[model samples]
Target: MIIVGKVIPFVNRKRELSSLNNFFNSDRAELIVIYGRRRIGKTELIKEAIKGQKAAYFFVEQALEKDNLDSFKEIISKTIDNPLIAKADFTWEELFQQIAKEEKLIIILDEFPNLITENKTLLSKFQKIWDEILKNTTIKLILCGSSISMMESYLLDHKSPLYGRRTGQLFIMPLKAGYILDFGVDSIEDAIRVFGITDGIPEYIKDVCYRLNSGERLEEVFQQDKVLFAEAEVLIKSELRDPTRYFKILKAIAFGNTKFGEIANYTEFPAPTVSKYLSNLINLHIVNESYPVLVDKERTRNRRYHLSDNYFDFYFRFIYPNKSEIISTDRISGFEADYNRYLGRIFEKVSEEFLKLNTDMLPFRFNRKGRWWFRDKEIDIVALNDNTREILFVECKWSSLNQNDVKHILELLKQKSGHLRWNNDNRIEHFGIIAKKIQDKETFRAQGFVAFDLDDF
Candidate 1:
């Protein structure tokens, strides 16, 4: 297969692979768009999908139009056994036509946004090419990009020339903990310590696997990936005009300034400006503006901002804050000082992701789930099955807990669950706990409550 980047043993991509397989089997040409934030495995997935197929793989970088077009011509000509493309200069339209004419082909333009920036009119230029020459051909064209905001705005936006041309689209997200954990982490605890902070991005997962196996602490893994230090900076600069200000806003949020006014005050920008910057981040999928866990008819209430990109969040939290010190030495003393607290918080998020997929942790087909809090009470997990009137209340513990500990935490969960105002009288409630490891699984099961250790995930 023609691909870029190191070969990752692709896993848990059955659905995505099936979608691409359908496109490949289609009788006519197909135009597909795949995108996500960087290092979430978009290129790997495409490479896996197009394996053993007649395909042309072109990785578009930020360069002159002729440079990118020259690369594309070379790949297409090689894949199709046509030497003319490399022997002489060829136009983009002519190259595409020659590649698609005699064979069923898969054409992948990876990092497509970089190509567009080099030549703004290439979007319409390719659209005209497709409509005029390649529309009824046997080629399946997949345009992939890393910038979520740019991909959506330029290619998928209603006003863009390429808007109505796509046959399918996929937003490849960060892998979940369950999908990433089997990479042979030493233990469940190790998985959470590393995967929790890395947010299941495959490349970061690989880094963690290498670090812990080599007897390094989770904090030291951060030092190994020096390239990641500048990753957040590059992403913010690419998407925002004033990244210095944006960095402050993101750093403020990472450091527990989530409210709109708090972020504004922390960054010393006006609230509206904070909101506009946040919208840009949200569009880029770098930030998430989560409303309350439950759906509310009234839209403008209980909105909270969070950094959704795990690496960006970790970088802002750990790396960006101590840039000078980290640059001095690969190791940062006291890196583990606040690590336990951070692990506790992220374990809840990791458990929430596990609960989304593991039916054993949740029964009765839950329709909604997330962290929930009222005036002074916060529930680590609150899952609802509206049809069955069941609510699963859970607490995630990064530390080990025994039967007695579980009893106390379950009691606290019941107390906090009491504060939730949704369908209180009509809904049924069940309590549970997820820990790094639980001492007594059967003790809670006997009481008809769900309980899990990391092994269950």
Candidate 2:
């Protein structure tokens, strides 16, 4: 029988899988660190890499230190083949010694941060064991962690025991816009909306499409299922200790509190504490610090925070507020309400991201562009050239672009140019409009601004 919504056994990670395979096949033993937000498929990727190969895998559990040691011993015992280690009361050093006996063994320590919590001395123990034993052995060690904050502390921080010991570091990011084609969601618009909404987190995307393929709309799937309703909570609870603080911080950002003061005010947390928390949130990949497109330095007014993960943004904006209604039988109505409330904004964000991706894919373009602003006015896109010192200002309107729309964007671009200090210093050649379907492209061109339609990308 088919296991519906199963991960389909690690499809489409050629680069990552090859990288690991190459390392394993190389002359020297390697220690690799793989990290990402929860459900971005780090564990699965590692598992897939070592599936057919001779390997020892340990998935740390949230238990006491002794239990964790026992669990690890069990996993090693199952894979180790030799009867010697099957019942040996060995230290971590002795364990690595036994693992080293293999010609080319792959050792994966998964959820490494959780294991560190149970045994505060684990990293130091591992570090000592690695330097004295494992590093010189033929065993390849893969340390994977979901807690970026803790992972960095253990493996990256200068003061930590494992610091400066890793041979390779790989920060596995969310799937890019190009990856959707691999997943068979080909339509650019549909891909952008789905990708932006789910932010390429494999599990969330799988959940969404699983529901959609099962004949459910975006709204109905999320609203009608308690399983889906708890997704945001599950995501938050995975990495954070006090999830309430993170929940409040996420809600604040979702509601458009980009500034630290705004987030502080919303969460009722002090500014310094909020600053620390935001740093942690960024480390965890839940939120990001967004800046003006042209700003060279980070400042209070230029910085804004947005949810880095697409699924979190969609969940908070649409699912979280209407959770009670969504988890009920009237979920269709709840979804309709959420759709009406968010579909417009979500559509706008998706359109802009589509342009961004398209711009990046364009060849020979030294500087790809997007929009920026200061106080009063905002821009849709801003393109700059390094050699020529020229700027291409663009305005993206998601909806139909009529004469009135053209005029409004033209006026906005004009305002943006006036506010900038470099308008006269840098050569300004063109202003453009990006839209779904321009009713009057010629009319806008005649009005002295180039018009780009949906197919421009």
Candidate 3:
């Protein structure tokens, strides 16, 4: 057997795919709805699950209704091993009815939103057909689409024709940290660094690996390829009508504006208009809104927003904006220069997110986790354990930590602790400082503060 590379089959979705299979192995037919943003591996998952089975695959195009119906009919006829239907003309209803009457028939309507757009009454007609004929039959109908809004509107929403008809809806997302080891990426920090850049979308991760060997840097591979330069644009342009506005909003978030008002001001759009766009963006899972921890200030303008997906965050931050500079110069050198300039900041943020992921291993889960400011003084991290009433104060320094760094963090904690009045009789406060490389480990240990070096992971 001449295998090219390791076939990482359905690398991390064993449980999800198994559950979906279990559901399909039931008495009657099932209506499964699967969707996600473009290139997030929806089709791959479905195809892998339905491999070697009696499955009909129809990828609906943005075309005329009659043409789409013809295409769908062709797939259905071919799937059933019917050679004669290549010359036969069948309407959508008749073809679907024939499929419904069969056993173990799986029909996948990919890009269903485009089909619905091509013909406005397709879902209503589908609902009528399902109610009258297909519902009682044994045809497993799987509808798939990339347009998050359109998919939700047509099937998942209350005001849609196919609402409440779906047996299961699967929103496929990118891979997370838990799957890093399975993908053959070593070390949690290294895995997180990859996630920071590639964002765990399988296609993006595979692309990164295709160019970069196991020990190679992403900036090297990403800068050499113009394909990655316009990747973010390609993803959004396919689904969104006006890419510029969404791009501006995304860039604003990537540039470090976390609140709606901040993003609007930075992007120079009106607040209400920005809000509407944000709603649409969040609905598509491109961006997310987060309320402050330990605070119920959601309605009082305290809810911050960011790109929910990590890959886009990396793209907007480094690749998309720096495309010309990267491609037009000595790719590796230019990339290294830019990377060295900003990698410290990126690592700090990654370390913070890592801490969130490993809270189970921590001494306490803090109710509040964020940076705090008072005039010129700033604290990098503050987490209060509401349950245990213990406080965790952390300071992250990219360079080697010095006496000044320790003194600064201690001063900030002293100031804030008194103001908040959060001390019990126990007064068990845990202070921690993280560095890219630790300095004076004995001194750090003497101070009863946890110090983490970048190599610790």
Candidate 4:
């Protein structure tokens, strides 16, 4: 009675699947913790991993403890072919003891935070259960949740009772840019457009794909009454106690207030308050704090915050700001030009993903890659191999570039590379450009420059 749920077209989680399968096939008991933002496909990945195995998948709901326990009992009875389980009222530890009796089984408690929220002592109880009963058995226990904060504080944090109990942990991330093409995007340009909004999140990509297939204009998907119009607000409210404050902070960052002082001034919050809120958002992976590439993070005072979640960035930038207009008029006015400009940044991210996937295209394999900036100068992409003193500087453009334009950009990039203080004298320098379209790309390549366009993606 191990039900394999309806299968969807799984895309691009090869490493995760392999790790999960290895844990499933292992000789020892496994306590695996999987967590990510909502709709990032944690449950689907778990279901896909446990396919054809003796597994019981119980979605933990927010309810009374006894009510949830009864639901878990029912699932267990059907999964293990034991009618007595349906009749007996068992505690969490007792139920886990019964699960351990099986020779081999996978127990996936989806939304595990719900369980811990109802009964905080469940952490200590589960810790005891694992140590006393299930630790010696062949049970592959998977605890999954969407509340990244709760999951980390309750299960993954060093101070928690369940700390040191997890045999493995997987932080499920969104699919990279290349996977967007698998969703029936007609071209890399269309894919980049989709990626700018969805950020390669599988569920969001599916929604965009459906709308595209149904002939809905891309902008129309974010119109009033659409699925994603208010999704960012909803997700923020669900995850944080103070959504309004976080929304202000996120909006500030999305609108190019990346520096700490600027975000504080824009949000009108005290500096200390801003730091605390930013820390919380960073823990949830909604905000990303980054330093220049190859810079010593601890030593450098230069850092910037960005909305790492693309959908959130799009929401704050476009949907949230125009909610009133969209509701009244059913359209966004004057967004096309700004959206295209936003795609310039998104295309840079897409280009970075492309570089990661095609590292062989570079002159030397790079150990580190990221944006580099100092005062007035910035490079779109900088990749370097510290061991070999090899460096690559690249520019990303969302518009088509002809030969002259390409040369100008490469020349500017080379000049800016002079500012990066990483082994400047001994470094072997390389230059590259990625754009929407580049004319005569081979001609540039023959001159020892790395150049690519949408066609290469």
Candidate 5:
């Protein structure tokens, strides 16, 4: 846990790091696949794992087969301290075989999809080499990629040559607000703002952390030409063949078009096409579909499409609309109206996490929890203590609510909870409110209600 130099120490990757690190001491050969969207820190995690150990990391890129072969030849040559190795031509299998002969190598092929894309047969080739040669060796092979769709289809699928070949696989994900905050931010408030933008992608967290440390303004953080600004654009272009159509669908969803018909109408794409695009987005972890919490799968028509993470939501909400504004002005004009409401919605998610973290405060342990809605009214946090026949209903307000304000909200919750109809005749009920800050929060608790503020979170 001691910092030796400039290393930021990977955050929220303890489990992953441990899995990879254990490879160093293992007595068997292994093939591990680590993948997710870009800037998700897969390469860094690999580097962290093999640090101070014998390892060869080749960052694969889109190029001719011979060119990539030569590139990796250089990497192997340097790692093995043999300049002569680079002077000769070697097939990838031969080069890998040579690398395996050198100590118990932690061999990482980053951007594995790039190699597969350029030569579709490379997957079968890898499978052949692994089964025939590498399987008997002590080398720990790790294939990593940012291409989620390709990685899933080409490696993890039952039809894939590499399927059932990997000893383990990790789908790296964005960090939660709490984990990112622990990594260091100005304050919890700034952490929330940063999460609103970065969604806890470590690379993005680093950028935001650096900017905040330098005392930069929000305007600069959101500048049109900033790295974070261009990230989504690049990702969209790479994953999507027709980025324009995908853009239209994504934009529509970000504009709060969650229903299939609404998104289809907004994007002017056919409903079937919209369904296909939404499925694609879901696969890419950009958007998700949610049904009312308590509804049966066969009976629900209220499925809502959600941009799966805060980063996408924030981008489509602010950056896409104000691209022109970003190009022209360096100043952020305001945080009024739409932006505030967006933050309010984000706060609901944040409060849910907060409630999850503070579960001990509940009167009973809840087995199921999610948003519940029927007709017009909705409860933001519904923690169902099913075994006890009780439900905790919470209303999340992004505004600063005084006890008086909270009391009225509570009255509304009472009316709203009556309609929940989840065995309501005999169900025990609990009520709560989560807000930016509650005036007289303790007093509300004394009044037999769960009330919390941002500080409590």
Candidate 6:
């Protein structure tokens, strides 16, 4: 079982932490909304932000509404040194009014969606409370939840009752690849391996770090009973009601059926059904649809669907297919070659992140970056500035490349660039390569090409 509150080192959320603290220090009342997928460190960031403050945190459980209210009252009573709060029976509005009596208070209702799910009327009720009672007070009311759809529909949507009432909203995202180094991994490659498995989710990274520091092999982290093995199913089931169909569609994409017709054929589902399911997955941020770089997504039919979360990508690609054998044998083996090929795709993602962080390596700062392809010709990484007509093409290889290999790959990249019709006449083109290791990388850099390796990471 995964342990809670294990004291993993918080790596990097400097901007988010600063934003929350600013809300805390504000003189007026604050209604903040915090949300993301499960185990993406929403709660940890809040805990860090409210470290020594006068805050009452209540994790709204999947229980009765009265039970959650009582729990909230108990927490607030203890936190604010008011025994009267626990003794008095009050509604959510009354409870907030009682809490608002204290100066500069922070009231956190985590899993706020659970409360709304149990009692749908709470949305308008809370809206009334905010407008009538809490708006004039100094209480910082925070509503956080893991249910992205529910949160967006009830709190953020324009037609919702709580619309236009929030002082600020934070949609927390996963950490980037570079932050993996802070987890005590020995090298950049090790960090990438961890990133491929954990997808920069802080809790999963902590679990992997704990296991690795305890002398366990990284492969052992994927054992049948481990949290990582079953996390994808839990996330999907929590978000989607009919998860079986979604699973088939996700597996289809995982197994290389990315096109609309390809997924429909593989799953044997109708085109419209596949479209609806893919839309749901896209909304949850579990899958992403992409067109070639510089192509308008709406105007193009040449789009492909891919898993957005790295852990989900790795899980569906490897674990879901061989789950029975892994469960029976209690180990994973004989997939190193295939796993390395999977890492090649992951390396492309890492290269994109690296280029974004180190944009000075490019000719001019790029405003757009993505994979580009036309017919059978594909460029791994592409960055462009529409205004300046500066474009960058990069090839990412998960294996080592010698001088000759780099030269050959650059030649192919240049040939493929001819197919791109963005600004063929006036576009200033640049080329580069990122790999596991590049021989004489400085030589390529001296030739005015962006060159990077694991050493640079």
On TM-score, the leading prediction is 4
- Give lDDT for model 2: 0.72
Q: Taking the tens digit of each residue's C-alpha lDDT, what string does model 2 give over 311-357?
A: 78777776776667665654545544654444445545555665566
- The ten-residue window of minimal lDDT in model 2 covers 1-10
Per-candidate TM equals: 0.93, 0.84, 0.81, 0.96, 0.93, 0.96
**Using lDDT as the measure, what is the rank order of every candidate, best first?**
6, 4, 5, 1, 3, 2
Tell me the whole-model lDDT of each prediction, alpha carbons only. Answer: 0.80, 0.72, 0.72, 0.90, 0.82, 0.90
Model 1 C-alpha lDDT per residue in residues 1-457, reported as the tens digit of each score: 1112334467677889999999999998889999987778898898898888888889997889888888787777788787787766777777766766755688899999998888888888899888987788878889999888789988899988988988899999887766655566645666666665678788778766765666666666666355566777987787678788789988999988887888888889987888888988887888888765684728665777889966777888888888777777876668787777677878888788778777654656788888786656788888888888899999998888888899899898888898888899899988889998898787788888888887786
lDDT of 4 by residue, 57-79 (tens): 99999998899999999999999
Question: Which stretches of candidate 6 lie above 4 Å from their native place?
Answer: 1-7
Overlapping backbone residue pairs in candidate 2 total: 3
lDDT of 5 by residue, 98-209 (tens): 8767657787889989898889999889998899878888888889999888999999999999899898889998877887666566366667777878886888878877
The alpha-carbon lDDT assigned to residue 105 of candidate 3 equals 83
Worst 10 residues of 1 by lDDT: 1-10
lDDT of 3 by residue, 1-457 (tens): 1112545557777766885687567667688899988878888888888876778888888899888887776776777777656557766676776777678787888989988887778889888877877788777889999888889989899999889888888988777654654555556555655666666688776666555554445666566454566777887887677889999899999878877778988999998889888888887788887654444564555577878777788778777677677778725345546655445555656667667877874567766687544434555677777668787777776566667776676666666654334555665788777776676755875777666666664
After superposition, candidate 3 runs with Cα above 4 Å error: 1-9, 82-87, 181-184, 187-190, 214-217, 223-225, 330-360, 364-429, 433-457
After aligning candidate 2 to the native by TM-score, how far in Å is the CA of 18 from where it should be?
4.6
Let me know the TM-score candidate 1 reaches against the reference structure: 0.93
lDDT of 1: 0.80
lDDT of 5: 0.82
Q: What are the C-alpha RMSDs, in order, of all predicted structures?
A: 3.6, 4.0, 4.4, 3.6, 3.0, 2.6
- Stronger candidate by TM-score (1 vs 6): 6
lDDT of candidate 6 over 254-289, digit per residue (tens): 888888999999999988899999999999899998
The best candidate by lDDT is: 6
